[model samples]
Target: MSQHVLALPSPIDLAAAAFTLPLFSLVLAALIIAGTLFVPRLHNRAGGTASPTAPVTARYRPEHRALGISAIAVILVFAVENIVRGYLLNLSDIVEWWQYATPIFAAVLCLAMTLALIVLKGAHQPERPVVPTTRRTWLSFSPRAVLIGASAAFIALLGTTVAAGLASSSDDRGRFIYLEIPVPNTEIEPLRPWFYGWDFGVPVLICLAALAVVTWATLRRNAMRPYLRPETVTAERLARIQVASGAVSIATAAVLLALGGAFRFIGRSGSLSQLTIGNDDTIYDMVWKYAEFAAVARYLAPALEITGFVLLLFVAIRLLHRPTPEGHGLRPQPSAQPETVR
Candidate 1:
């Protein structure tokens, strides 16, 4: 067992590339706008938690900041890598790919947060009525259905547009990788140009999941014909916010869908095994290159995806407030207290 190092190409680090503050900033701006629109409703649901830690909002707003940091991390990397490497397959300096710590970290954290949010939402049960005439507060808005629907549509359209823009770039599909694996009996099996799709998968998945929630909520709300019982509502005063939140969700899904589609086009060359260059084991040259193409998911897609992801996270946080043992379910306050009625 001998360890032999085969050399091929340089790495892609955005730090070595050109950094565009405006582009990244715009994405952040969108996230802020979207989050602002969604978080308050979440606040209402979890408002009365007995425990200070019981509130999802307590942790969520800060977590969104973390998401912003992750997006910036990717942005910085893209700037450095693309600017320095500039799509050149020089195969000399042997730059190893940058280990993306931010998104990966964000991925795990987001999962934990999302799971926590769900559990909180689920633990709630209906409150027992103390009075005869039953009444509950239904999360409501003036024109909820119409406004939310429009928002969703806008987001969807934005995603599609971005995808189209990237596709038009010189390197629309993204990057290519080549590897040299040590095979059996000293013969080397050189891997080909493949294995680097779904770079945007995390953001895409998160965004889509949020969009699904929005869709589900909208449909549920629409179905409740005459009067919406407080027990029936998952949201508290979400009608106005839903409009914006729904749009954010749709926009996220659209961008992710576009990113996936662009990757699919690049996949046309066949993802990893596109250039299977050898038969023997242990000793061959592997050439992997990151195209300096204009269409980088790290740049465009993540912004929309992450923005939507965080907003949804905020929504979930707001919707699923931490409850107390005594406050397992929310009760509609009496229409009027006994003394007041008298």
Candidate 2:
């Protein structure tokens, strides 16, 4: 097999062309504010009735408050780093530092948070006695529901991408190729097959699969009505957090899958073979002049992924430091035995 090389813009140039810090900042800020305001409200509204004797003072424990603040700080730091990196990318000749450090830092933070959650135990409150009731048939917020819905959506998006790739090609041989317009008046050529496979196929599958597995496991482990240990007042809160986090992750996966499909559509719809070249102007002249317009998803998808990751991290930290149960102070202490018998 012969290798066909299409001259394309440099990675730095593409990154600069695709993203700008100011616009990214505005979008990020809006999402953060919306999440801050709405997610908790949604949880509360969906949450069942509160106990009448629940204490009103210091709803959040000291550790919970500290974790919340730390989570917010991490998000702010990431935002600032992105803005600075975006600026540096615009000016610097090499973006190696930003490229290497940003994701590593983010990953480390998330990993550390996960480890902390697993190792650290929260203050345990006595569990209330379970009342015998008729078993419900459906649980909308169950792990099973989330897993099924997310898996279906992911498969649908994958199918859509395959269809779009086929539709975009001029030949019926089921090859995935797209045009590259690096410079005006240049020769028209198909993008490398390996590039397409790596860029379009690999990342989508990995992200979707990883997110699905993690979410399914987390939700299943913390089901709404698990057989609770005697001293676990925060069980309800933890369950709610798990559900909310899974919901957000599933939603994020859906958005990413939709964006992937859109990217494929854009590539397929703008195939060079579909257009006729005249004597004066070549295909490259017509296409490369407007390459930026066509490759919008190249930048948008990563942006969404970053946003999703940050949001998920926030949820994880929130779960790690969830407020202690109000009944923690009221649980009866174990009785002392008299020493006279001894």
Best by lDDT: 2
Give one clash count per candidate, in the order shown: 25, 0
Model 1: per-residue Cα lDDT over 300-327, one tens digit each: 4344444433444444444343445455
lDDT against the true structure, per candidate, is: 0.36, 0.40
What TM-score does candidate 2 reach?
0.43
lDDT of 2 by residue, 307-341 (tens): 54444445434434333466223332144212110
TM-scores for all candidates: the values are 0.30, 0.43
What is the overall TM-score of model 1 with all chains considered together? Answer: 0.30
Q: Which pairs of residues have clashing backbones in candidate 2?
A: none
Q: What is the C-alpha RMSD of each candidate to the true structure, in Å?
A: 15.1, 12.6
lDDT of model 1, residue 126: 30
- Candidate 2, residue 168: the lDDT equals 37
